[model samples]
Target: MSKDYYKVLGVEKTATADEIKRAFLKLAHQYHPDKNGGKDDKFKEINEAYQVLGNAEKRKQFDQFGANFNGAGGFGGGQGYGGFGGFQNGGMNINMDDLGDLGEMFGGLGDIFGFGSARGGQGRRREPQRGSDIEAAMTIDFLEAVFGAEKEVTLKKKITCAHCGGTGAEPGAKIEECPTCKGHGRVRRVQQTILGSIQTEASCPSCGGEGKIASKKCSECNGAGTAYDTAKFKVRIPAGVDDGGRIRIPGYGEAGDRGAGVGDLYLNIRVRPSDKFARDEYDILTKKEISFTQAALGDKIEIETVHGKVELKIPEGTQSGTVFKLKNKGVPHTSGRNIGDHLIEVVVKTPKNLNKRQKESLKELGI
Candidate 1:
């Protein structure tokens, strides 16, 4: 069935160019192949879908062609328009002048698909690729999050075997072309349907889609070219990085087979709760308790800041819930801005127990 491009991009068909760009960017960031695990095909599909729908002229042609537009064939296969088999096979005979700006769009898709003009020849496949990215969660102390700290984390991941150099073969061993797909890495299955013969291509199961078979497999990786290793690394928590913020550590994730670059590691941060202070942007909030006598008769009180103890004066008759702001005494801003203010809320504490003599003295003063 023909996929709906607008639906793929999560936008209406009548969406404007700006709206289409915004929607594409959001979804692209969400499902980018480098970030989203187990969704690489979906990411590629949406990117291709948006490439055609984001443009006006291509959209018009696509709307005109309806379901007959063969994205795999790079458009112009007219099973919808007046029986004009559209362009010739291999998309070679299509008139470049008619495609207009779509040439660039197709060119970009070709880069991803490794089309004829790409480094690989027609139907030529590239090397085995990197593994998908993985996400992990880490918790740090609030003070560490504010001041930035380095931590060592250990995770079990697959890494290319050092014994065989990721080729999955014994030392100095040769690789032979796969017998299943005959070095194609993919095999076509033709289904005889009511309309005609429909061919579908699937990865070759025998060679695992690599199109090459190792003569002797490496004992460590068992021919998969990767092994499980306990990866340990130091992760730097940047100052002022808030909770739920992500830190991307590239090339520290799972290793790829056949010397492919390692996948990326994503750390989802969680800040531990602070007992004495609360964070608000770059500001810190705290509570201070004072005696009723101190509030009634103004006095100097000592309070604790992240820095140290500081003396603050309380005015006479100071009410409860009064907030005092201390400038440049809060968390540091990541952008190098001035330190935020410290907000201290004062609460007057009443005496809970009094001796008989104290009670008598109070009664003599009041009664």
Candidate 2:
């Protein structure tokens, strides 16, 4: 059956080589069997299309022949088979060497083919990766959050093994080349996929990509290079750190493999709710109940703030639910530039179940 390679890859005939490759990778990743809803037949079609249109000479010949561009039978070349191979078992077969500059495109696709550690598209070797960041939750009281406090956190984490000196070897151990990957630290593989035979590379598993093994393993840490132990570290809780705030401590997380960089420790701050106060940004909010007499006649009342107890004056005939502000009495700013104001909401207490004498006295005063 005749096939349009350009249409299969969703590219125009005038598409450049890079554009053709980009389109093929997109479609390939989209329809890969390992991915969800991946169609095997569609992936095969995309591979077939790219095998022809992705190459410069093959693309030129494909353009010339319009749809039937078999270099061996249709274009001459006999049983020599040209550079491309015939389809077998409903799969398009092609020479791996002919796919020039494909190392980058096929890199990291190793997982799909069960290939060893694959390099990135850039073909650069993977370096020692940093340890993962650790997350911990801390609960501080409202006052502590406002005033800031230094507290100790105990955790079990991995650290560089002192016995191994951050190395996997024991004291004065000889190093030898790995036999699995042949000292290359990575292994190459040719895998049969819906796209055809794909060439991929991956890090060696036996040596953990180090390409070397120690003659004597560290007895304290086993063969691994890190030690797992419990440690207590002091963490400063900064002021104005509201709930859900996070503080990062660098190089305080798990130690990296070998001698690589360590990870970070992140503390998630959770402020305890205050019985007498609520917070808004850096401000403190509180409610005070004022009696009917106090609301009718102006009076000074004591209100509890984040800083301390403060006096608030209620104006004469002050209505219920009136809000008052106390300057510089709230929590301090995280930036230390300014302090927030303390907001006091006044609520008038209505006297209920009054005595008969009190009710009669009120009636007489009104009359």
Go through the candidates in order and give the clash count of each: 0, 6
Clashing residue pairs in candidate 1, if any?
none
Q: TM-score for all predictions?
A: 0.55, 0.71
C-alpha root-mean-square deviation, each candidate? 11.1, 6.2
Please list the C-alpha lDDT of all candidates, in the order they appear. Answer: 0.69, 0.75
Candidate 2, residues 217-304: lDDT per residue as tens digits? 7888775667898978898888888889998989889887666688999999998898888999889988889998899888999988
Query: Against the correct fold, how does model 1 do in TM-score?
Result: 0.55
Error of 1 at 24 (Å): 18
* TM-score of model number 2: 0.71
Q: Which portions of model 1 miss their true places by more than 4 Å?
A: 1-126, 167-169, 174-217, 335-338, 351-367
